[model samples]
Target: MFRTEISMLAACALAGAAHGQNLADLSLDQLSRIEVTSVGKRLQRVADVAGSVYVITADDIRRCGATTLPEVLRLAPNLQVARVDGAQYAISARTGTDLLANKMLVLVDGRTVYSPLFSGVFWEAIEMPLDDIERIEVLSGSGGTLYGSNAFHGVINIVTRSAGETAGTLVKGAVGTSERFVTLRHGAASDAGAFRVFAKKRDAENTQRASGAPVRDASRHQLAGFRWDGGTPQRQFTGTGEVYHHRTEDVLGERDYHGAYVLGRYIEDAGGRRTQLQAYADRLVRERSRTIRNTVDTLDLELQQQQLPTAGMDLLWGAGWRLYRDDAQPASPAALDLLPRRKYLHLWNAFAQVEMEGAAASRFTLGLKAEHNAYTGLELLPTLRYSWRPSEDSNVWAAASRVVRTPARVDRDVASPPLVPNPSVRAEKADIAELGWRGRFGSGASASLTAFAHRFGQLRSFDLNGATGVFANNYGGWLRGLEGWAEWFPAQNLRLKAGMLLQHPRYDAAAGTSPQPPSVTLGNDARHLFKLGVAWDVRHNVWVDFHVRHVGRRPAPAVPSYLAADARVAWRPAPSVELSAAVRNLGEPRHVEWGAPATASLVPRSLLLQFVWWP
Candidate 1:
């Protein structure tokens, strides 16, 4: 049945093309029109944003044949995405690429996903139905002025489709060499609102160690979620909730985790003024190992307002409050423990940004954020930006900002076999500057280039005092880099994109004459990175997508440089049915992307077949 349907579509497309009816071409203007909200915390044209930003659209996701969020992220050339195993990934931007990359912030529909326990994301535990995602906005620079602390390097925001747009039934299934997944979704529309519910399950096999042994990293996960949207465009209300359970078996032992969250949002626009209020609550429990367990609960509330107070002037402001309660314990005496078995943390923040048109075809933006955290009494983040449009198709921008990464629970409270608590640890800070240019040539080409520099202080390190190790802020560093990308469309049916990155990173002790501890190490720093992608619409209903990436050798842990390639071919038999096949890591059978002692298993080449049905 599937083959027949696809064959029918192929024949139709061939017939139509032979009749001189060409498919619509995707122009540069259309691509630039995609609006993004992560840059300034409000909707803005992608071309108008004064930062290094990239957008992964729904079409890009479908054509890439990505089964996980990190796989989808690989399309963004500005980001460094590495797979550690079947379920774990390490992702960052510009700098600090490691297993625990704490400087980057990640959010799903305005809800933060970074765990305060370690200030890093547990990628394995965060799962969502990929079909529901509308777009992902990636900003490769500091967003501290608007997002507050921990936005020191970059920010990623994932947006989902509106319930009204997904009013139907969808079922999808996939089987691959290493994993199997299934998803079901149902949506409905009523006089008062639109709602959708979805569920997904996945199981993955283990990977092989460098020594050619199975790593025992198999995993399984299940997730369910729902979303509801109501009211008119002028007065809208949204409610969403999700729950998930995951289990994994690794070298250490078996681990289990489960979590749930609910969010409510209300928005109103009257007389050219817009207001938004949001609230959310979440709880999580994790058995990290056989002898370690932790539980956390969080409640957050926020209010925001946006308006065009005057011609050529735009302003947005918001305030938020968050509370976190945590409980941790060790089942065995040899396991790690928190200084306080139970603890509570409070956070309050307010932020504002104003944009105004200046003389000489330029725009200026000023932003500031004031935040108070339990560990850091008070902190201030500020940014200034200027953008100049020399022509209708070109833009030049510059910006400067101050950002910080606050101490996490493990930094100041952890006490275990190898880590000792240190109450004196301070926040890591950086002063960043950037300049960029973006241009569009004719209707078939576009390009962007950015250069950035950063000065850091109060970097985190370990202090060994006669066999006991304690965390401290005793190191500093300087980082400079260049990132650029170009896109070309030689034919209406073909599109190509290429990107490159180069960086120089250095670190040293803040206090002269003090030797660095052996435990203190900089993250995986790649000096050069390159990526190329191609998307060809073979026919009106068939497409082929291919990507190639080359990562330079990293310093610590010493991962040799490697090149990887991925390809996917997809066919849409009807408006509601699709079939696709994909191959990943085609360049090498198995290779390690990260990890020392070579603990991380090698990422193996895999092939998958997928089918999607919507009615």
Candidate 2:
């Protein structure tokens, strides 16, 4: 059945490619001029951002042939995205490569998505309809002053299209060796407002171990959501809600999880000034191995204002409050347990940023944030940045920032079988400095390079000297790296992008000269990384894209270097229809991207066919 479905989709794509041109065949010149908003919280040309930033547009996402958020994120050069199983992924930026990477902050439409339970994101539990996403903005350096704690290394903001922009019906389906997925959506626009609703379902097969045995990591997921946008010309209102359920089978055992969230926002713009009020609530429940069950509920509120207070200055300020509650229960007495059984957390923060444009094309920015949490008292974060524009096409920028990662539930309250609580754990902090340059050459070529150094204090570690293991902030370290990417459109129809990263990281004991753990599993750092991508408009309506990536060896669990490649061919047969075929992991049958060598499973190659209909 899978083969038959894929064959039909391929046939349709080929037929469409043979036809005439379509709107999807946008010129490379137009794409380079796209605008981005994450750098300074205001819309600006991509080439003008002073930081190491990357933008993944909707067209780019369409050509990548990715089925999940993690797969789509692989396109960003600064991120390390690793596949752990059929439904799990380990992703981070600049530092850390663990199953629960906690250094990077992620937001979807202004809503934070990380779990306070582990101070990390559970990739498998977060899902969205890919077609609804407008763009993904990735900042490869500290953003603590604007995003608060946990934005220690970087931030990823996923922005979705407005309801008015999607006023139609869309249906998408895919079948492949690894998974099957389907989606249905409808949108409508009226004088009063615009609304959209969607439903999606997916099922995936299990991966294999090195011995060619099935790992039983298969999974299934279902998601439904709705979005509404409306209001008068001066006042704008937006509301969104989603519900999801997921089930997975793994080596440890079977797991079931469900979650729901609702978000609302009101924005007003007048005379070069803007104000926004936003609120959201989320609830999640999980059952693992038939032995452990956990539940979490969260409510958040924020108010922000932006204004051009003076001819040469721009000001942005915001305040936010959040409340979180967690409950854990083990089916068996000897199973997993959480201290206090039930816990409540409260967080409050305020932030402000000022940008000044000086004479001779120079700009300076200063930002500060203060946050108070239940575990940690008041913490302050500060950042300073300067940019010099020598010409319209070239820019030089530098920045210094301080960031922190606050303790999580696991750090202060976990009391599972072999682990004990440690209420004394403090927030980990870092001071980072970065210098970068961006330039646009003749024609459609552009490049960016960045060098950064960071000194970390109070890093987290696990101590096993006592009867039960305890988490502590007992290490310090220095990390330095160079990262860059270049893009070129050699021909009118061909485009190429290449990126590389190199780093050196070292750790030492806070007190004595004792040797640190040989297996630094906390933040697995890789020394070298590289990626290359190519997109060619082979014909009027046909497009082909190819991507290759290499990740160097990591310490601790000792993950060896590996190379992977992907290719996709897409065609628009009609103005309202598209079809594509893709192959992932073309270089190898299966390989382990992360985790301990002894128990790691292999991620296998996959062939997929997809179709989209809009009318």
Candidate 2 structure quality by residue, lDDT tens digits, 1-615: 000011232223322332322323443334445565666766666666778888787766777889999999999988888888788888888777778888889999888999888888989888788888767888988988888898888989888877876778989999999899999999999999999999999999988878777888899999999989998767889999999999999767888889999999988878887788899999999888857788999999999888956889999989999999988887875656787888899999999999999889999999999999999899999999999999988889999999999999888888765778899999999999999998888767888899999999988887775456777887788989999998887787787899988888777776843334724435776889999999888887788899999999877678899999999998888878889999999998888887775678788899999988887
Candidate 1 stretches greater than 4 Å from native: 1-25, 512-522, 597-599
Model 2, residue pairs in steric clash: 16-573
Q: Per-residue lDDT of 1-615 in model 1, one digit per residue for the tens?
A: 000011233234322321222335446776777777787888777788899998887667777778889889988878988887777887889888877778889988888888889777888888788878777888998899988798988898888777876778989999999998999999999989999999999999999887888888899999999999999867888899999999989767877889999998888878887888989999988886757788889999998889856899999999999998988887764667888878898989999999999998999999999999889789999999999999989999999999989898988998886678888989999999999999999988999999999999888887777678788888788989999999998999888999998899777786653635422434676788999999888998888889999998876767788899999988888877778899999998988787763676899999999988977
Give lDDT for model 1.
0.83
Query: Lowest-lDDT window of 10 residues in candidate 2?
Result: 1-10
Query: How does residue 13 of candidate 1 score in lDDT?
Result: 32
